[model samples]
Target chain A: MPTDFELTIRPRKGWQAVDFTEAYLYRELFAFLVWRDVKIRYRQTLLGGLWAILQPFIAMLIFSFIFNRLAHVQSDGPPYKLFAYAGLAPWTFFSTSVTQSSNSLLANHQLVSKVYFPRIFIPLGAIGALLLDLLLSLGLFFAMMLYYRWPATVALLWLPLFILVAVLATAGTGLTLSALNVSFRDVKYVVPFLVQMGLFVTPVIYPARYVPARWQVLLGLNPMAGVVIGFRHALLGTPASWAVMGVSIGVSVALFVFGLLIFRRMENRFADII
Target chain B: MKPILEIRELSKQYKLGWQRLRKAQNVRELIADGLTKPLRMLRGNQNHGPAKQEPFTLWALEKVNLDIYEGDIIGIIGRNGAGKSTLLKILSRITSPSNGTVVIRGRLASLLEVGTGFHPELTGKENIFLNGAILGMRRAEIIRRFDEIVAFAEVEKFLDTPVKHYSSGMYVRLAFAVAAHLDPEILVVDEVLAVGDLSFQKKCLGKMGEVSRSGRTVLFVSHNMAAIENLCTRGIVLHQGKLHFDGATKDAIQYYLNSLSTRFGTGHVVDLDGVGDRRSIVAPLLKRLEFFTENEQPLLEGLPTGSKLKIRVHFDLPGPTLSFNVGLGFNNSYGQRVFTAHSMFEPNRSVKESVGPQVFTCEIPSFTLMPGEYSVKVFLELKNREADAIEDAAKISVLESDFYGTGKVPKNGMFVLEHGWYLEQAADAK
Candidate 1:
């Protein structure tokens, strides 16, 4: 016999409840959505998953030309190629995931309006698809490290923690922006500008050590700054700043929590507005 | 058994103005309002009740109460803006109410539309699972019923093909098939059957009937009164965001029909009220409508069959009207539109663009309406603007007359056709 559960619906009087259990129950749908996005992303492309590697690779070449060759930007610790690649890997993942996930609600408005599932799944699935690209791009970073004859270090194990930091940061901003996009569609226009501007401020093309010492902590407030620095520290054995990592982690977690709060509150209005 | 679902004082309010702003940033005002709302509430500067202070507020559903029992099939019937869709959306949790509560005793699956989450590039097999999961079916359950669904939709050959390649009919068939197989304590369907052809529609209705007979509750919403009367044990009528009637299907349909009958009465001129507000700044407003005979006599109540008919529509324009269209529809007593005539389609016969206080009259040389009770609906459209329509604006009954000059009246269909019968005798037989 099928199990029965009672449901009561009323006007939302105050702050909304983020039902973790309900989200857990829909884990299968979450997995399916992620899988669907991944499959469809590369389905028609001739290069398929190769585009993932090509994007950051091409960006690395341009950064190497412009920042390293033309401007003579100091690597500060590692070679410019290795330094730029490390930052680009995490940066690409964060930017792509944030941009895609922010538009997830609008892209899947059909499902949002027609069915009842945790609306969080759409953006999360978008992030999940980008995770594949992140992993693939990380492979190129390692190859560049090998070409530079860089030795592996125990710090490599800390890479997953930074990856977690990146995920949290992306999820927070993505979910909040996605919810906002449902109501104020200007988020769609705002996101591209955000990605472009974020690349310059995020220490992707330059190292954190290049910044004046006094402003380093402020740079850490940009969540991607810490993830990029942490990735370089893990992969290239660069100088590590516990203070900056702490600030970056704090900012990412806070952004995530704040985004979640705004997302949950705005979720009920999505179907009506979108 | 106790009722499976109970709804009390359910209402939904919507803001109408912000939706018109085509740009995405316009929603920022609403967000800003929401952000500052709490502080205002704390300071006692906000209105306490569910009072709509905004001029553009629309009460899509208002103070609606309903209860559904197990093994019951309830049909929701209403006009275009009568809140049927809003009620379904609230019930399915697609949107929440502004007040009151709805309680459900068991699992409910709402097929507000078939194939809600279908991806065009996905193969038929994949879409089955995807759509099934979206509709609240478990993977194991969808797998178990996969063969049955494929057979019902008759798409076994295209199982591996992407749905984008399938014809529209095939798509709808497969979508409805997957939706039909969902096993829930209650199912809510909204006009999904209107898409498919006749045979497919019948098949879908049959499937719903089967589901209902298996002791599951069903809530159906449709504009088709015949389908509601045929399948539902109970009927609900909503009018202008309020529950007008709820009872047996027969009585509910009768009540709805009675409401249509009251829209227009036996008079030469019908003044419309309660249609809608004069909201548009540029569009012309329909001021007066009248019916007449060929000799320009005021038509009242009944008109003889085969008599010439004329209709005069008076309009009030704020300024010179530009590229406007007016149309009329005739429906039988059963709430089915028989035929419609529009000025847009007959540009040569249409009225010229002009300013305020203008009357446009349409003449029918031979009115061939069969003897029966009928109603008229008026529609007005301005160039590149949303059309305003008032359904069942006037009611006129066609009286029986010797249209054939043989003291007999044609009693079949909605209208009569002029034709002559020819006969020949064979020479051999003679």
Candidate 2:
């Protein structure tokens, strides 16, 4: 037999690093899974991709009415509608990615149990699907910026970096939760509550300036806090907070690494447990 | 020739009662359970109670060492829970083995289930790519063979339609077509041909034969004896998590059959649960088989020729009642099926649609089989699908008798047909 490719199988011992090369080899499958998720999300729906825009758009409306109109929450600079939307768009992306990817293994139990691929792709593909929705909601944010006559600024170049931070944070939390969700189904019930509570803890509805100055550092630990503030600074020319961004980026990277470790440790048992 | 795959001391242990024990009522209890896990491990033997006589762990597979060479089509056969699937899973890397190691020298692809990653909402074209990629084909390869796959499945016209709308036949065809096109150095398949229609099954068997002929190694697990005997060059029988026999396909099949008869001893009433040669996707539905005389008494002595015979089959049906058929096949000592009596043959005799344990008795007014040993095969079908089939379920000896109420008897054929010969003169003879 030709010995071009050799594979060794044995009991995995202790903690192992994620097999990035194996995942890379199955990149086509990962891409297909992401495509499938994106296609299935919109297929047969009355409103197709509009659901992406409508999710955050509707949330922004509700938050503006309650938090801005009634409570008179501070926006820091831009109109509360645009400011709230800048935060809501990425928040929607983060929350939905977390929820969907957390359940990805359970939902595709057949795939996980029957086929061999980098199981991490199951959750990562789910996050990849929501990236399109993030883009869609960002389109609505750009339109809102136009309506509010917010001129373009070079700070907009930082938008991708902020988006990368959000992706990292989502991947970190989603991978950890998805892996845990395989063994302990209680993660399913806990995730929604966590995401719901997450919105208040992060600065999705109000500016980080509204919080006490001392606790602002704690708020940056949430990762999405810095993402929301960064989105406003990038899109609406609001003053950027490098310290909070540094802390959030650091937290996001740490979470991502921690999540990968957990995922790699638990992935071997996923097929049996799931 | 050097073997393409080598496995040494492969074993897998599953925690049997852990899922039940892990059923924590709430978060606090779950946390407490986690905290006390190490302590409980330390006190393991002391915690064993009378009610927990069964061990908490099950060894699904023991030290199974195997070496498979290239171009060998090996049929892995055993009863249900015989570690066929566990071995395949370990080879496919779907689950890790608890002990030992396996080394493979070439690319391997395993098809445990067809249409595994197929999304009902995805179009046929989309599913083809998705399923192909899931089966470990590169996108470029799928793109190159896209047309061939579509044509082979005969779904060219509906390639853009969602798979949910495709007929069951169409779906299976498309799925198999994609799988058939996969060209891996080593391929492992389990029971996938059990789906689809008979003709499609034939086509799939043909495809498998072609694949084996092309010199790629194939490992197949199946309950269909004929397919295994026809397609495999070698066979491996796993009995109760250990490698029982491994040799040429013919010897392996004989070994499996012999082992099965001994495992479930011959008797008037045989429990079907332990019967090895069953082809059923569902759980053990046909529970037992009992043989009786004309008057429903258990037959102890050999059945005399021309005497009435009755066979009773006991089965349990779970869930709502559906249309089903039971059949009994009589095969001579040579393994040639002489005749079959199927419930579907007499459609007017509707079966009672009651749930749970039920008995169906079939009676023949005159036993016509020539005095010889014949094996009885029982099968049950639910909605035209093979729910359960057990070959050589029971054996009966037919005693020689005056079948025609004459002194002479025919001894050559398997069956005796009633006939009268009259001396007649043809025109030329007259």
- Which residue pairs does candidate 1 place in steric collision? B264-B394
Q: Against the true two-chain complex, what DockQ does each candidate achieve? A: 0.50, 0.47
lDDT of 2: 0.86
Q: In model 1, how large is the Cα lDDT of residue A71?
A: 97
Q: Cα RMSDs of all predictions? A: 7.5, 10.3
Q: Write the per-residue lDDT of candidate 2 for residues A28-117, one digit (tens) a residue.
A: 888999999999998999999999999999988999999999999978888989888988988999999999999999999999999998
Off by over 4 Å in 2: A1-3, B19-55, B269-296, B299-430
lDDT tens digits, residue span B342-396, model 2: 8788746776677788888888888899897777888887667666787777788
Question: Given candidate 2, what's the lDDT at residue B209?
Answer: 98
**Candidate 1 error regions (>4 Å):** B18-54, B267-270, B274-285, B289-313, B317-430
Residue B332 lDDT (model 1): 69
Q: lDDT tens string, model 1, B1-430? A: 6678999999999765321211124467667656664554444423332222222467889999988998889999976668898999998888989988999999888999888889999999999998888888888999999999999999999999989999999999999999999999989998777777788989998898899889889999987777898899999999878999999999999998788667654568888644552233233377778899857888876899899888988776544556777788887654557778777677576455676676777777878888877768777766645335666667778898888888776777668888899888967894
